[model samples]
Target: MSAMNAPLDLPLHAATLNPFIAQAWRERITPALVDYIAIPAKSPMFDADWQAHGLIDRVVRDAATWVESRKVPGLTLEVLRLESRTPVLFFEVEATQSVPTGAQAPTILIYGHLDKQPEFSGWRADLGPWTPKIDAGKLYGRGGADDGYAIYAAVSAIEAVKAQGALHPRIVGLIETCEESGSFDLPIYLEALRPRLGEVSLVVCLDSGAGNYDQLWLTTSLRGNVTGTLKVEVLTEGVHSGDGSGLVPSSFRVLRQVLDRLEDARSGHLLPGAFHCEIPVERIDQAKVAAQALGESVWKNYPWACGADGGLTLPVSDDPVELLLNRTWRPTLSITGVDGIPPLAQAGNVLRPFTAFKLSLRLPPLIEGHEAAVKLKTLLEDNAPYNARVTFEPDGRVGAWGASGWNAPTLAPWLERAMDAASRQHFGAPLGYIGQGGTIPLMNLLQQGFPQAQMMVCGVLGPKSNAHGPNEFLHLDYAERLTASVAQVIAAHP
Candidate 1:
């Protein structure tokens, strides 16, 4: 039935939705989410044998089974597989009634990922990567928050809205399994399914972060990424450190010099005229608002441990606004992993022949990942100190994204009211907006395809959620409220 013809008395306020969504999650969604988290559906990057392991396939089946059990009216579910590519779970909840040919009923697209990051070390012993544990309202495991709850949340919202006797626009769910691998297969699947994806008016993405668990956080922009291995080779073989100390240049030192070309050693600032773009005035204003709302939590929320035994403490800028800007709008470099180094116990007093460092660079929203990767490779390879052998091999380049021409006059007011109601009712706080210091490569593709649509990115990854790291978790109460917020927006979509 057309939403235009739905009954006007349907309850969409917090009084009705809060309890309804909460009950749905308690009775239906939570159990399934826990089960989903137990499956080790590691992304292709981490598990090159994902296809052979069948973990991705198992996740697709799991989501399909849960969605089917919900028995959402007019729902059609399918796992779309392109040859040799990761699966895309495509499901649609149809509108109840038909309208005139010239009329337009908004089609809202929901995007999320079922794949997960590798199990980083340091998980609390009680919480294993694939072991599901619920303690004090937090679901602890991999993928639960970094976004395993997304498909369940999306379907639950539709069911809750319909149960309230209100109708939503046509809702389409696109859950992919290659997101953690930089979504390389997404563009292919998207192009193949372009014809079926109708005129989209809004896009809801539940794959971002919140400042805290107290209120809903909307992502205004997402940083981009370039990942690769930087290697420096100085000698054909290792020699005693005492013999080579005077004649040989340490590969580790050469690596440091090459990295200095990209970022300053003292300030950690990216070199000028490298991979940077001017920050828009609007983003700066949004950063101020987010900083005010987040306060000290902006820095304190991180799980930083003070160095024990006369070690250093975390050093962050005192100004939260500058910290937020540096995180979301500026470039940063981190050496995630290193090779060719022996453990302390096994190390001999020898100069290493080669050193390989895994480089993970986060770029501003407007910088292109491919361009950044090229520039970095050139910078490292062109001027090798002592003409040593240097090779920069990029593993992947994931582009950054922002909401371009992101005016959503109709959906904006509804979202504001919905978030306000949901936040106050659930957390006794108000909703806030901020830019995330991460990348969701799929969003750039969706924005490029549906430039005219309103895109709202929000999720359950809040402070201490530790997504992409050890001790990852999903705040159960927050996920429940976020589902209701989604339901409210769906019911109110124009």
Candidate 2:
């Protein structure tokens, strides 16, 4: 029978799903994940000498090696590379067209990334960023949670479908290695492989966030990013504070002055007109639905640091709905890193020569990130406070993306039913929808490329997963169910 009318005995049932993929994770993917996390495969932005370091190559090689060992019936996996750019592990899994209905199947594209964020500070003492530690069913390490499990998870889902004797479309997997670096090199590879990639009926992305671990989380939208460096220089060399305190201005003060033009100092609200946009009615309605499902956890689920006063509170409104809107529909700025600042232990009474800050700004779904970057540059450089040498250098920018999730008539209901079935079978709860505050540059590109294709963005990064922060982890049980859910959707696809 065709997949449309096939029995729902596709091995994703609670009885078979957990035991099958759980054992697979234990015997195969977990060990591989441990090794995957051991490598410091920091993105190109963090490791400027990424090619020389070879960590990115090592990750691609290891994952490719694992895929080769699978030896799927008609699988072809290769590390597709562009000149001087990071490699993308491409896998083409031929479809098994043996259903009784004998209907033609559609082509599917599954996208993921292998590159990882840099090791930020504050990991628990016993758990280092590269140290693979498994505790109480959670795997503690980098990349494994943020997305190192993707390739293995995708292949496992396909395998689950095959084992059930279910029919699925031809699978094209694009696992890039530069997603964490704003995906600058992705367009080149996408253009080159356009012919082979062809038109896709559906796109499955396993690189997004989850609202909670109890149920499947569908990412309905993703915020865009505009990141750059802001540098303020007051003097060519350091001078004793006593000598320069009155004679010259502190670079830190000048930096603050420049930032004031971008955002309100107290409220943390964006002040620039280019960064603001009216909230869409559809998104506002979805946010209310999501808020009801998420409830208090909308703010409570964050892994606040210890003793940050009962916990870190929101800089804006306390209402969960407003917080959700602030995160996804509003623009926000964060100074991720600073240079020319010495450790507190090495205190000096000298005025520093310059202060440079790495700024990461999240744009609303309707805002244009590149144009905002230009506006930001002009705002900071137009009037140099105290005639300081101030410069704003933008690294890269990508616009936010919103999917027609509820409006995907052909596949939305089918996937939702499959997702609900998988969730109830595994976790006893229904699937939920939430907007992701993070940025995924590829989603916008793919949505533009395949406007007719339905997109389902889901992942295992749930509460306190701390993707880019310290103590990152992956919930093993949730991942198993998630993989099964993916298989269920693939098997049920028309």
Candidate 3:
């Protein structure tokens, strides 16, 4: 967005790019994506019997079939399955433009995933997670924007480039179905397919969020995640509350006390020093810029409940920049799921034996996820309140922990110029940079493997296009322009 950013090269068929992508989404991708949304292909964590359901397999096969049917020039698609892991769809588009003599063409690795989060509660009367509907030009459904649209957009971008007979390099797409579950299965496939995944100079990950739908936003960093269940037990069996009132300690109260060690209940700040990291100066500056680009909408966009007195409810801070830093650069804790609680209607005056809560801790980008998980387990499980039995069990391999976060390498000058050029060409605005609070395990993996690769991490999860929550929708107009923007970047790739 700066005055020095590279000016756009005459767009290779710029006049027709949007029309081509728009038609592609309307006639080809949307219908298929609709079917994709309807499948309820929840991630493995949500559906333990995913294999028996066969939904993952069906969606993979369908996506593979659609790609093959595209018949793009020099394109070959494969649905790769590792004995027990979820499937990944890998496709390649050979270089089209003549490469300079003595220079190997650079490879562009476009990454996304087909897996989706579980169908959470609180859907609108007309909308459901699996029911795809088009209202007001947005496609309402889960997974459609979160990532099911990635492969479709990736191929369509290639097609747009080829349709113009534009100069383009080798491009490969890696769409896995386990991303929502921390991408636990991806490392294996990355190793097995390492040889095939050529010198990847660029990674176009279309699974992050945008500051807004008005302009292009690049994710500069992502927070890591550590999730596990913490349970506290004080009694072997349930007893009437009146009878056990004074004798037995409350499991819920004891569990809360243990969690107090990890987080400040009132302020919501994670207490451990290991969970915090130094916020890079560049990221702080970018957050300020992004905060300006998107003002109060940064936090006000969230659906917070009204206060008891009918006044507005507030976030941790009202400062836009601080809120941005808090979500992206700082660590926080959330209780996602719970057990050992009775429904209000079924509430018996009984003392429960145990209380378990699913804890999801978001860590700063530099903190190691597994190490944090280990530390969290120790912090909570060590000191027993009233000597109550408290245990912390984490998800993922014991040593590996959950997903570690990623901070992208320094932006390459060429890629920065290309991105700004693409943004100007498509959205009539400069490109924006923001750090996303969500974790993308694959980004860290790819950065570790290709340390020099410039990451183009952008997506359609802008404003209220909630990916995991109900009423999720994909802004069709923005997506169409974004598709064209991606094509522009690829055409500008050196």
Of the candidates shown, which would achieve the greatest lDDT relative to the real structure? 3
Cα-based lDDT for every prediction: 0.83, 0.82, 0.91
TM-score of 1: 0.93
Off by over 4 Å in 3: 1-5, 97-104
TM-scores, all candidates, are 0.93, 0.92, 0.98
From the highest lDDT down, the ranking of the candidates is 3, 1, 2
**What is the per-residue lDDT of model 2 for residues 102-205, given as tens digits with 9 covering 90 to 100?**
55456788988889998899999999889999999999998998798999999988887777777787889999998988888888898998878866888899
> Tens digits of per-residue lDDT for model 3 on 315-363?
8898999999999999999899999898899989999999999999999
Give stretches of model 1 more than 4 Å off.
1-11, 102-104, 307-312, 397-411
Give candidate 2 regions above 4 Å deviation: 1-14, 98-105, 305-315, 397-411
Best-to-worst ranking by TM-score:
3, 1, 2
- lDDT per residue, candidate 1, 1-494, as tens digits? 22223233324866877788888889888888889889999999899998999999999998999899889888999999899899999998897566679986678999999999998899997998899999999999999998888999999899888887886778888999988878888888889988778888889999998988878787888888888899999999999999998799999999999998888988888995766778888778878988888898888877767688655456558899999989888888899999989999999999999999999888888877777777788888997999999998887534421111121222355555655555555676766778888888877778788877887789988888999899999999989878987887787776
The candidate scoring highest on TM-score is 3
